[model samples]
Target: MSISRFDKKIQTPPENPSQNDHSAPEEAAQIGAARVERVIHGGDGLLRLDGKAGFISGVLPGELVSFAVLRDRPRQFEGVLREVLDPSPHRCEPRCPLAGRCGGCDWQYCHSEYQLELKKGIVAENLRRIGKIPLERESIQILAGEPWGYRERVQIHTDHRGRPGFKARRSEEIVLLSNCPVVTEEINRFLEDAASGKILLPPGKRLVLVLADGESPDSRAVIVAPGPQTAQRSLDGLPLSFDPSSFFQANGPLLERLGRELRSRIARDAPRVLVDLYGGAGVLGALAVSGSSAFSGDLLCVEEDRRNARFIEENLLRAGLKEAQIRVVSRSAEKALAVDPVLKNLDPPSSAVILDPPRSGLSATLRRWLKKGPAARLFYVSCNSATLARDLGEILGAYLIQDVTILDFFPQTAHVEVLVELRLKG
Candidate 1:
């Protein structure tokens, strides 16, 4: 016997729905033999639910549990698992106190190895649903890297009256998290120290981006953003900068691997002109080439953030490469590319665009321009595949996807980063 959602039409409760709501009820129940229908990612955002959409948390395939049916949507029912009457063989004890609250990771209750399989399934489903890409289940490889200490950056949220942490799955409520077990001890120490007033954070602040080079033994920079200024630091003799909102990759292990892969591909493309769109600190371009033999026409970086644009220049200089046609366009991606005369005048078939856009995916305007742009190839790297899939669908007729590598950047979780190669279709 289990608490089953009875097609009940749940109404929005009063403004102040006690530390509980109508969906959660008087008691929990023990059920048996619940079938796993399907899994759904709640949009491209952090909310990834399996077993059922709009269903409550803690429900997975092959699990019999007592769940509270919270809210019902047109398509799926949302609920919270009150008790796992029959735990799946893949279920595991979560390691973090903030696991359920932080909402940053949705698959903590699942075993790390099992999570990789789930994510791989998600990718295949997305390709089939969105791109009509027919990939057999056996053809797909579920990829996974190290499960712990993989992230180099952590974005901590702030609150005035509540526990400062990430938002809940589908709501704006901030889940209090003083410590996260999955993060490296280095980061956990910083968070613990911050909790004790060692690091002052703005009250009601939305986020605090912490960045460090895992490879750097003796150096780490603690930079807080949108508030006060922060100090500087370096790693592996590479001049790196971070000031609160400088948009550094949070998962450094995968990023390092991703960077090396980009560098390897650059030799083959041998681009004459390189345009870094949505370029944050110009890391991609910097990693692509060695010291001197740079792009012949122009090496450009475009970013809207003035602070990040400066860091890009500083990074370029530190790499010991001459500023041959290096232009930092201070505008949005499309505006910068469209208005710059030098960028437009590059030699024929000489330009290639490399972009890492914000999670909302590339701007539709930007996608339109790139489809018709003179670039020979486009290397689009994204952490959010949902938006990337959406963007690809938008421009499918314009460009053909050449190659794709789904990176297990955020191991032990459902998040995936992909490096996709695109060439204009005839």
Candidate 2:
């Protein structure tokens, strides 16, 4: 179990040598070296040192690396990669000079194709290990585009000098940026303009910049900084009104693909009623089932934010769902289900539900309700796989997984968007 033999060029003492001594300070920022056993969900490499499991970012499996322990415990430690004593063959140089410092992207050290492989492996491992759902490696589908310049939305902060930048990794300190490589060209130009004083921005304010359309670089961008002003965008020709602070998908092409996939699945299932949970701007369900000639189902969007009701209604109308029964409930999913008569009387056989909950996944009450087989079909879109696996495991007795697709929404980063289709077990 020792990795000392793997590399002898650099030798360092483990953070803790005594297994039973638990009085060490929590913030033991010590330097140590270990061989990475595997990469985990958040793009950190898992390794063991002195009989204690540890995790360090900016590394890959089989690489012997030195790290600075940010947090040390009796059983485990969290650290940041300091140096690679022995590097993995799949490692590559990051495109951004500030990749290690800026918190914008992780896995920049990993090769592009290897990044996909790591994501697929992480997703499958999470499902198998956490949810007890096992599938062949080839069974999980992956949707990816170019590995760079795909982000349509970016939020930048202004330092005391009004310099726009992103926060450093694991710290509040702003890392000044001359340019960003992962954002769209338009955003990059805008940032450059702002940085060069061509575009004046308030100092010490959070600015949210988003393009009106991802594919059209010529389109105008909507920049908001603490105001009543809002902006409008389109999804598959459906008009969407959103502020810069809106939570729409950042990757445009892959979002369209996700919409198409959901549309095809919902159309094929022919659900008479469609319920969109945690419907942020009513984008997912509205754009998904829109323009489907076979879809004449009633639409219900439940969102806790009442301000989004107008946008939801507007998008639904733009989707040509005027004649169909459409209701926007501005309440949490749990409360909305209890108060709304339609949700209470939903016929599972003729109904479908789209669960795009937050990164925390479904609430316990909602999970319990879903476990009772509330819908015949379920489309669970998740950005966090760990929580997704936990929630899926709770309801597996009632629903069986039919398909799992990994969409590379955030490239050059540890983040991923997953779409899981489930069907009620008869």
The most accurate candidate by lDDT is 2
For each candidate in the order shown, give its overall lDDT on alpha carbons.
0.62, 0.80
Q: Alpha carbon lDDT of residue 135, candidate 1?
A: 52
Give Cα distance to truth, residue 409, candidate 1, Å.
3.1
For this target, which candidate reaches the highest TM-score against the unseen true structure?
2
- Cand. 1 TM to true fold: 0.79
Which stretches in model 1 have alpha-carbon errors above 4 Å? 1-33, 43-54, 62-66, 73-75, 135-144, 157-178, 195-209, 212-217, 226-237, 290-297, 345-348
Count of residue pairs whose backbone atoms collide, per candidate: 8, 0
lDDT (C-alpha) at residue 78 in model 1: 48
Residue pairs in steric clash, candidate 2?
A: none
